[model samples]
Target: MATRRYLQLDVFAARAGTGNPLGVVLDADGMDTASMQALAAWLNLSETVFFVPMQDPAADYRIRIFTPGSELPFAGHPSVGAAWAALDAGLVDADARALVQECGAGLLPVRVEKTADGKRTIELCTPRRQALSTPPVAIPASLQALAAADAAPVLWSNGPAWWLLRANSAGAVRAFAPDFAAIAAFTNATDATGLVIFAPEAGAGHDVVVRAFCPGDAVNVPEDPVTGSANALVAAWLAAHAALPHADGRYVASQGRELGRDGRVQLRVDADGDVWLGGEVQPVIRGSLDW
Candidate 1:
């Protein structure tokens, strides 16, 4: 039997077993594509991240993210989780300000932020581009499978994928019971592997609330706990449409309450046209893989 090491971390959650869980293969430097895909399928998390050394000093490492079936261009939770795993294990030094994570999408910056607790939070910067003038004119038929009588879907993107639905009321958002099979079919049909459903938050503390689902890749389940990227994209889309109250600073989105995995993510948008997403990743399992 061949022995390999892997680290599992619970991302976008303050504690373990709550947020979107991710598996990282530390010895993935020499593994081929077929092996990576097989390992991802075996781990069966939202995504599995593999690291390869890069020659450029500008970038510390080459990171690739994969689901059970295929590789992904970009993803928020896995990026956060993988970076956390790399740093926490002392694989990447602390002094690095910016490390370019090379993925299918291209080289993206993973900027490190120091938290109050002395831990690090990595914000993956998205490529600068103009937001689409308008969201999808109407909800797609697949999204309509989860739609209510009052609200339809809105298509928006940041990096990974765009949210397809935006409800008219808090009740409408909460009442959406998605058809996972239909969602899977829809995902297979489009480049988007995930979907975001949202509406205004009911309480006064936050601006809005939302839920995320990624049936195409990891955890073929519905309602991801905390989604920083989706919320950031949503916030940007909202800002473009002049819907949100604040023009600057960070916004927090809370999700996964209905699905039992309560989580939160903070999104920061600066005047310089840069978006920052922050979340916590807790190391859950330190184990090995024998094949």
Candidate 2:
């Protein structure tokens, strides 16, 4: 058996145990797709990352993201965590401000900025065709099973894979008691795999609070800790369409409150139409795999 090594880290968090966790396969140059899927199932986390060092000078690297069920073209938290892992591994040069990652979806740039701690921060390019979907005048009969009907539904996305929905209030988000079988049926019916519902903060000093759920995978549960990139894309979409104020200002997002592992994520949308999601990460466990 051949042994493979990987690093484990928590992302989109200020501290440990507060954010989404990821397993990063540091040297996946030879691993195949079937192997990756099996490996993801073995990890049993939300996502697993595999880094394939690129030989081409023009490319920074390549990454493969996989859930337990299948591979994904792109994912927000894993992108950030993977870039940080690459930097920590010295895979890319310090002066390399931009990284081009070739994934299943396509080639996307992972922009990097150096922090005072000598770590590089990563921001990924959102998909060009992010959707703008508004709920019907009356709540759809299909979604009536969701906890709150009074809240408005706004849909958007950063990547081709997921459609994010922003709801009206925090209570509405927390009260979501979904029927997995029904939700899965709906996803297949509509060709949507994931849904994120959020609400505006009730008080000052907070920007927005949200919850993310991906039903395509087994158990069909919402994530305990979701990263800020998807939310940043949603915010960008909202600012563009709704004319929301402070769209250019730095925003704070609170997630995972419903699951008791509350997390804070920072976001900034630039004038150039680029969105940035920033957060800290910490290493939790490390191990190897046999293939």
Which residue segments of model 2 deviate by more than 4 Å?
53-57, 94-97, 114-120, 132-157, 202-205, 217-224, 243-249
Listed per model in order, the count of residue pairs whose N, CA or C atoms clash below 3 Å is: 0, 0
lDDT per residue for candidate 2 within 33-69, as digits (tens), equals 8988888888788888998766556567778888776
Score residue 136 of candidate 1 by CA lDDT.
33
* Displacement of the residue 206 alpha carbon in candidate 1, Å: 4.3
Least accurate stretch of 10 residues (summed lDDT) in model 2? 134-143
For model 1 the TM-score comes to: 0.84
**Cα lDDT tens digits for candidate 1, 48-146:** 888766645666667778877677767778777777777877778865656676666567778887777787777777654333334334434646655
What lDDT would candidate 2 get against the real structure? Answer: 0.67
Segments in model 1 whose C-alpha atoms lie over 4 Å from true places: 55-57, 95-98, 128-159, 202-206, 216-219
